[model samples]
Target: MIKLTKLAVLCSLIALPTQALARDVNDLGVDVQAATSAYIVKNTNPRYPGSYNGSRLEGWALMSYVVDTQGKAKDIEVIMASDTRGSEENAEKYLTNLEFAPATKEGKTVEGGYLFSFEVGKYFNGYSNDKASRGFINEYDEINKLLQAKEFKKAELALAELYKDHTKNTSEQALFAWLKSQYYYHQQQWFGFDEQLSVAYLLRAKLPTDIQYLVAKSALQWYSFKGDFNLAYNAIYALDNIEGKEFSEENKLATIKQIDDLLARTPQINSQINVSKDKLSYLSLSRGSIKIEGASDVSKLQIRCADQVVDLEASELVNYVIDEQSRRCGLLVKSANPAEIKVKQTGYAIVNSKFDAS
Candidate 1:
């Protein structure tokens, strides 16, 4: 969590990538002119959920919806919600009444999809460690002490008890996920650390900007150090997004440089993960191509973008080479035994690749 302190809650719901990959517009087999992006024609503000009134809980909702040729938002999906109770419901209701200007291709209306995130209470600035239940605070403190003392056995028991005993609201879930990630990191459980930290990262969407920044920064440090280039890129991507918006151009470059420096000694990377059952791994790329390969256990590859989601069987990805122009994507692999997906970044950035660990 070094150097990125000022970035507070800009991106919401899910952590963002630098620039998402969009699909090629020419899906039509016949000749079609270049398509123009859809735009918002009208909007309606979402009403506050009644459950959130005066509650210490806070959260955000991320949705993906299709705008038909008539510019109506439909096929709505609540991608993520921090407060599961009503956050998704609010987003769905809001989108049901939303309007848009349909995208066009060759002067004719065409369908398009887009993602949107809405935050509740604009982040839970009212909630803090002091506001947590005494039981949670005591358990957290005791676990911290155990972790600090390298008493892994005790820390493990305490963490388990904390989860089962505590009423985990949004804030507590994020905090507990981070503490669990620390436990994994200390035990040198790289994959566990990555997955748990990612949970912590996403769960903080409605916490606080400063908290979000620290989580993102921690992710960047850990992923780069472990040679998990795919996620490290995501961390830096989200960080750059915040910095680019909040700081001046020069300052943005400086802040990004601080991140780039973290990966300076890293070698070129091909990220992979092993799974014994169903698993999904987010894939990101900025300037190069990627070829995804794995055991036949990979049942499908799903690449989702602002406008579309594409699914491919494992057979289809064997020789696939994703170039600079391709959008960022992810793979959903299923297996009866241990199978893996290898994401090889066969490109380089003089200032891009982070740690040499991969």
Candidate 2:
């Protein structure tokens, strides 16, 4: 598979209108806020998830329209669009003769220019690639609309369908991977660790060198999230080897700093797979004291402390310790939300609290 470099990520995400339609921001006669509802409709089908050359190619287009007092579209413009000049000219021709119900402001008909951004794309909905020529952006919008209308299952079904089918085109595929990874990560799907790693590794392979840093960064993110310091460190070092030759010293240092931060918090992380953990949980002034409970049978527990809920995590347990020089320490223990404590065979008791008591 061709490694789709991240450099073209933005391009891949957006469908280029056949022609460029951006204008000087000053030429937008009205403030963006005022033209909220105004839009110029087009006759062409917005490409979304569907068979183009007999294979699904996911895409979408966005355009803005200036409306007149007569409820007529005075101008049709593509915003942040990519396409040929001929397509743009055709879009303009379609807009010039377009009709719209005039708008009213302060009880009077007023020439109002509004920007309308319309999109259509594929969704996870059971709609197959053969059914819709678009992908995620369109599907996402429709699902959102349904959700906004309070149709949750319908929206979910759309997503389910998209996931089942077009889970390959970089866009559609990425969405599925993201949702699955998040689900497994949150559930601490330790069994799926290698699969998750494979996806991150694959993404790293696909992204271009210019944006390979992002891939490496993502890998580090998974490593840290999984509390696998060793793996995270290895990934960081590997990235350093690959990127060191090309990136400036300052850039490399910045990346290293991020990795260092991740490493600094390793000790507080639970080594056992069955434990539910909170490195930092929030509290309010209305409550004092926290209770800690075990997520499962464990012999150790830990929590990082802070002056406030500013920075809390299971790892870096010492951070919760009150500084001797400080007169008052923020409260760490709470009543209803006591940090449920737990421990593994290591016999660690970790809990973090911030206090500022005089």
Candidate 3:
């Protein structure tokens, strides 16, 4: 006896031309009229079972139906459901009775199939109240409070403890990874932060939409800070593809603007060394390697350390080392042309170098 608690049908007009409409209903082709303007006309709160055995089962059920030219819903079908007991049946029944104002295309009545996703769960402001879920929620809140208070060490300790407990739930695991990433970020552990954030981003499909957006946003910032233009570009691409009724139009637009701004400032890491005459050049290194293209005219590349000087050939790719003792070193590039040589450093700060070799 599961009581349906809240039911909301988010109708998005998938604009398709009349000519593209498939004659066969089984084709899975969308035949919706392009609306000049669309709006949510109804929101229903249905009753659902609160919990089962101290744990709440939360999932989404999708129902597809066509709004006829007469403004009546017809040909209702349950496309997918997480729960088969009654959620799918109820969604189908509810959608069959739902009505909508007829959609229009070029000022003519047209039938359109719309997808309705029913969020089935214990909705306490979009949070579950299941015992296990509640435990995690409470722990997260506690950690969040500590973080807000700038108790970073305490937060880290708490997070470490939380991570020790094994949980098979995908969403919970994602949440934990996200929190760990944030903690590392606050600690200024950039490598750990980036690694953990990547894990969260990959597991985003299992997370809630809001959490997914957060993960993407955080990844964008991390990649930008690391000067990883490629990763930043990928993050923006992910943000662009994220679309749903759960996200507000304003927020989505704001995120797009944020991505644009980040892209504008991101450096193009082509991994090429451009050397000019008598000018010291600096480049950020990735994995202790610098690939210098168009260096055929160069004669010699010399790296000067406190103890020794290592000379390298003017090849397509070069590798250098920066040990703890020789962190700050000098580089001298001698080329046939008055070249400006670029050396990529694989650390936070660029090593001191002098390009005095003529």
Best candidate (score: TM-score): 1
Model 1 pairs in collision: 8-209, 9-209, 21-327, 263-354, 266-355, 266-356, 267-356
Which scores higher on TM-score, 2 or 3? 3
TM-score of each: 0.62, 0.29, 0.38
On residues 1-358, what C-alpha lDDT tens digit does candidate 3 reach at each position? 1111111111112222221111111111112223421123432323343443543444434444555666565655443343325666655655554445655546766555444554433435565432236667678878888877889989988887675543224456567768877888777886566546755664455566677878877766766665543344445545555666254547555655664554454333343344444322222222223445445567656543222235567676566554433321334444556654444544322221111000
TM-score head-to-head 1 vs 2, winner? 1
| Candidate 3 or 1, higher TM-score | 1
- Worst-scoring 10-residue span by lDDT in model 3: 349-358
lDDT of 2 by residue, 312-343 (tens): 33332323332222211112221222234322
What range of 10 consecutive residues in model 2 has the weakest lDDT sum? 4-13
* Model 1 clashing-pair count: 7
Query: Would you list the C-alpha lDDT of every candidate in the order shown?
Result: 0.52, 0.36, 0.47
RMSD of each: 8.9, 24.2, 21.6
Off by over 4 Å in 1: 1-46, 50-131, 205-213, 226-252, 258-268, 275-279, 295-297, 307-309, 321-338, 347-358
For model 1, residues 192-272, the per-residue Cα lDDT tens digits are 676567667755442346656778789777766655544565565566555323535575456456556654554455666
